[model samples]
Target chain A: MEFTTSQVIEILGTIAFAISGSFSAIQRRLDPFGVLIIAFVTSIGGGTVRDLLLGDTPVKWMRDVNYCLLILVTSLLTIVLKRHRKRFTVTLFLFDSMGLGLFTILGIQKGIAFGLSPGICIALGTITGCFGGVIRDTLLNTIPLIFKKEIYATACILGGILYFTLLFFNLKADVAKVLVIGFIFALRVVVVRYKLSLPRFGY
Target chain B: MEFTTSQVIEILGTIAFAISGSFSAIQRRLDPFGVLIIAFVTSIGGGTVRDLLLGDTPVKWMRDVNYCLLILVTSLLTIVLKRHRKRFTVTLFLFDSMGLGLFTILGIQKGIAFGLSPGICIALGTITGCFGGVIRDTLLNTIPLIFKKEIYATACILGGILYFTLLFFNLKADVAKVLVIGFIFALRVVVVRYKLSLPRFGY
Candidate 1:
């Protein structure tokens, strides 16, 4: 299988996600192993969910040693930087938004590969981009950001739609990925900067 | 298209997992929506896990409305009987153990269908049968049962191996399921009764 540039970006996005998760665990006063687990889960959890949805076995992380090492290194870095967590949240969120955008496209691409309809692919993309954070927040006993603040996961959905919509116009795959990621990142930036929010329902 | 006796037991087990999860959520004083999420996840989590491993789509609950309704009923029951949660833990454990054994077999069966060899099948079975509880605990911000006292994901792995071993002798599938569930359930009972413990790793 070709590890395209987009796939490489996807891995970096995963690493960034792991950092976000590890920082959360560190703030909660968890031990190093606990930190690593949180990092590992938060980074790859969504992709793992997507893979499972597509019936891919051994998961990407389980198949690739690099993902595991990324989480471990991030965890160690988290422990070393425990004193600076509050200041890191904003920095982490930036990386996370990038991850969100990238994973969304990756998930959509996988769904397409598995022959799912475009509608399902977009939903898969949204889930892939957001579910890891949901799992992380839930584990930390906080309300998930996806359900609360920012235009995060929703941006991913819109971008994925744009991806397929652009593809229908016969846009190149590389260009489609760039356009979707750009859309998500910009949407997230505008939402965060303006303090925008999604409407919440208790049910 | 045979609904093997094992399949029947697996359904019952799913119900058990749902009950346990709902009850646990009550002990945590979750709201109604929280209860439903917990119950639904508990019931379908393992099977959903197994299906994901097999690269199945829509997970299991998304396909069948009954699974959702069953979990809904359990959550409703929990809301009604919130006062008696401690008393219900025993009943929940009984079902959980049954669910554990049945899901284990289901996982192994799915693995075999995927043409996996016995070793991976057992591992998949063990993961399917246990990961849900791990997830539930992680969501609750508690250390998982895997790190604490439990006889095992215990019965599932043993029963998985037993099922494949029995198949080596070409025993009837129904008879094998009964034997495996019975043995696993008995082992669980004995373990709980004696307060059995695994050797702990020092942190």
Candidate 2:
């Protein structure tokens, strides 16, 4: 019963998004069912979109009920832990960024498997990293952060480029994967920490 | 130079959604580029989602460049017709409802092709009918009308049920398809005209 590295990353990412979505839903004062639905969507949304684009049918979650159970449990735990609401924002951000990093790499790998071009793979990675949050925010009736803030997708794109570059330099696959994930997570944290944002056009 | 019934319905649905999307974007004060983008998503978003769920690779627009061109033309035409602003809302509703009916039948056909259960086919039909508008409204930062108002999806669902019933009664396939589409379009118009709405839970 050994889980491959990709499997591990996927599980971790799922949990991270589940936590992120649950916190956001609870913050919005959604009912428990609504919170759970948000958690479920945030956990599986990106991968589902990625699979759909690649024509991978039955979608991952539809075939694997375990992922659904995992989200249910994780969301319930997050709800039960709401007494520690002081750290809500930080917790949600951290988990979301972590999920973004992990899911981006997974999407890139899937694209590579499908023989998609490098640029398309990077686009897929960015989509996989950002779409879950986009769906979550959209369902919550807010402008998606991806459209409002550029750095979110930027980090994933940069991480994708770094992955390809590392592989070009003959870096071990596992090492490059870990490095790219850490790079994305750290980049997002630094950008937010420094209050960095792209200039917007006044419409 | 010959076209099948399905192809005609698909084209009509695409054009209808493109108009619906462009009008929505223009009303939201988006620029030309933004309007076109919204129109593209509204025209293809549901089919893309349905294909992904069914693992249909390359999706429709990706494989057929003609659809893209059609959407582009349709969107531009919609923008040009913008000066008829007084009738915008009514025009949008008419095209949207027509697209919903057309796309719903197409989706149900696809589901049957895949040998999916009737229930699942109906679900797919509803998704195909409604998701483009859902995506368009979400991108525009509005609560998707499907969630806020029940009749949107309800019309699709009822039409799906009607299609199966018609078939069960040995109605010709072509006749049933046309009837279902007209039924959905009329049902939605009547629902909105009468201001009928499902009661909401005050949670």
Candidate 3:
């Protein structure tokens, strides 16, 4: 089947999150069923939240069994790949970053399509980008990476703004999407590499 | 305003969860803002998930600003009430149990309204009853009582079954609803009183 650019991005983001979730679950030594459950949650978590907030019902995954099949296959592949791979942390981080960028852009576009305000769109984008990881980490009893890494949602928000700016400047929509995704992915990498974080405040 | 039974149950459940969440957040020493946020999540989390699954748009809280106002007021009331009371744990537990019963019945009725199968309706009921506390406990970084106690979702499931059975037996709808809710609430209390728990297996 011929796929649109948006569809391709969605598939890639889903796969990336599935693999990332598998790695986290495996690291926690969860059983296979637990790993698959986590993978499903991570892969669909963001989109589900975005769709629900937009009042788009039946959720994406519930309506599309294909996504469920894809996540299952990807998770199984991740398990097989783990046997041959020694470095999980770095690989997990890379796929998660890619998923974050891709999902964030998609969420922003969805918000725009829904006729929401720019601020609400950015919030939606950030939520779609970060909530999967947040839920996954929370389920695994770890501090969510968003709480530890300040730049996580910031990257999505800034990338969202950039997308709107690019659109305003007459950039091709396709080109703008790619640029925004690359911007978010690169921003996350740079921040993590430098261990950059916002200052902590006591409540 | 003439409130229907279902609306009354929804309001009571919302208030119960709001108070329960406030007590939890306060016990954790979170700021007032944090308490309000948790309260909102605990009250609306299950309903939001249910709405998304059933293709009910705008979810509950987003469409009805009154619910948000209710939760905010309830949370603030909880905070004020805390100053005059030294025993919060029991109160929190009681309210949580009541919320669980109320939400489970509401979810089952929604599922029935949607023409879902009995099994699916039961699952919806369980999810609607338990997910709020699950999210709340996860956010608080504590082991969810559902996982530890095992009776949480079980009560919802059994209660759901009882509701269906009563209807099948020609019991009045309103009477059945009240009976099921009371059964769930009382079951929880009895199980906790007896320290009943399912056996845990290492995964």
Give the best candidate by DockQ: 2
Residue A176 deviation, candidate 3, in Å? 18
Displacement of the residue A166 alpha carbon in candidate 3, Å: 20
Give a tens-digit lDDT track for model 2, residues A48-155.
Answer: 888778778778999999999999999999998778788888988999999999999999998888777676688678879988998999899876766544378778
lDDT of 3 by residue, B1-203 (tens): 89999999999999999999999888877655567768988998899889877878756665566887899899988887675346777888899999999999999999999999999999999999999998899888888978876489999999999999999999998899999999999999999989987677787
Best by TM-score: 3
What TM-score does structure 1 among the candidates reach?
Answer: 0.58
Order by lDDT, highest first = 2, 3, 1
lDDT of 1 by residue, A1-203 (tens): 67986678677778778878877766665545456667877888899888876768757664565666677787677566556445766766786787788889888988998999999999999989998888888766777878766777789878988999999999998988988888998899889989988777796
Candidate 3 lDDT over residue span A58-153, tens digit each: 788989899999999999999987864678888988999999999998898887887766756776788799889988997998878764544676
lDDT of predicted model 2: 0.88
- Candidate 3 deviant stretches above 4 angstroms: A1-48, A52-126, A132-141, A145-203, B84-86, B197-203
All candidates: interface RMSD: 7.1, 5.6, 5.6
lDDT of each: 0.76, 0.88, 0.87
How do all models score by TM-score?
Answer: 0.58, 0.60, 0.62
Looking at candidate 1, what is the lDDT of residue B85? 49
User: lDDT per residue, candidate 1, B7-74, as tens digits?
Assistant: 57666777778877887777677887997888877777777776765567767788888768877886
Model 2, runs deviating above 4 Å = A1-48, A56-142, A149-203, B148-150, B198-203
Quote the positional error of residue A111 for candidate 2 in Å: 6.4
